[model samples]
Each structure stands twice: as C-alpha cells, then as structure tokens.
Target: MLSNFLPFLYGISVFVLLILAAKIMLNGFVSSQASLKTQNSFSKKKKDDRTGLVTVHPELLNKDGCITDEDLLTVRFAKDSDHPQSSENPSE
Candidate 1:
C-alpha cells in the first residue's frame, strides 16, 4: 500500500512545482512587457524642454506657476549645499 502511494505523491509534487514555476515565469514576463511598453511609449513621445518629472516636484514653481529669483537661489543652494551647518557660531 505504501509503494502504490509513492508514485501519486511524486506526481502531485511535480505538478505543484511546475505550477509555481509557471506562475513565476508569467509574472516576470508580464512585468517585463509592461516596462518595455512604458519605455517605448516614453521614447516615442516628445518631452517638454522646460519641464520634467524632477522639475515638477521642486519648490521653484510659484503661485503663478513662474520661477522667481528666490526660488532659483533656494533650489540651487538646497540641492548643492555641501556644508549645510556652519562651523562658526553666530554668537561668536
């Protein structure tokens, strides 16, 4: 009786492994296809010269949607300031 159950258990284990492998492969293929589609679409489209994903999130845009001098200075300093905290004390 134990010998007869061996083949059935083996077959079930193989089937389950195959199912898991297929699921993983299908998920990978779907994600890759989606990424490819996005890349192709982005490549084909013309991006605005003045605006981008990085630019949009910045604090430069004013209430009127214009770049002011304060905004420009703030952005440049905030992003590229190497030494943010000064070694000198203000009370000194």
Candidate 2:
C-alpha cells in the first residue's frame, strides 16, 4: 500500500511545481521584460554626432550626466588600390 501511494504523491508534487513555474513565467518574474526594455532603449539611444555616427559610451559620461567633450581619434586605413604598386608584382 505504501509503494502504491508513493507514485500518487510524486504526481501531485510534480503538478504543483508545474503550476508554480507557469505562474512565475506569466507574471514576468524572470526579468525578461526588463532586459527587452534595455535593448529597446539602446536602439533609441542618441548619438554624439548629427550624422548618426559615433555612439557615446556610458563610461564617457561625466558626473553631471553629460558626455565629456574630448577629441575623437581617427585612423585612415590605406586600401590596397591606394598603396603604391611594386614593379615585381605584375598589375593584372
């Protein structure tokens, strides 16, 4: 009789756990909504330039809640075509 009652007890416990899991998920207790909000906020974030370039990082912000003014460093990459061709390398 005890052995037969064990399966029934297990089934009831499993059903209770499933119900709790469903309730937690439906109530958004896993913070999925908060993460989605942060992702959407980044998409709507303002850039430092009017050309829509140069995303200002959060670390660059000053204590006054503004982006600190600093010179932006840029490097011009030399394309292969822009490089001087050597005579040894036959130009196709």
Q: Candidate 1, residues 1-92: lDDT per residue as tens digits?
A: 99999999999999999999999999999999999999888878866543554456447667888764561332335578585554447785
Worst lDDT window (10 residues) for model 2?
A: 79-88
TM-score of each model, paired residue for residue: 0.48, 0.36
Model 1 segments more than 4 A misplaced: 46-92
Clashes of 1: 0
lDDT of 1 at 62: 77
Cα TM-score of candidate 1: 0.48
- Give the TM-score (vs. native) of candidate 2: 0.36
Q: Give candidate 2 regions above 4 Å deviation.
A: 23-30, 48-92
Tell me how far the alpha carbon of residue 63 in candidate 2 is from the true structure, in angstroms, after superposition: 27
lDDT score for candidate 2 against the true structure: 0.77
Identify the candidate with maximal lDDT.
Answer: 2
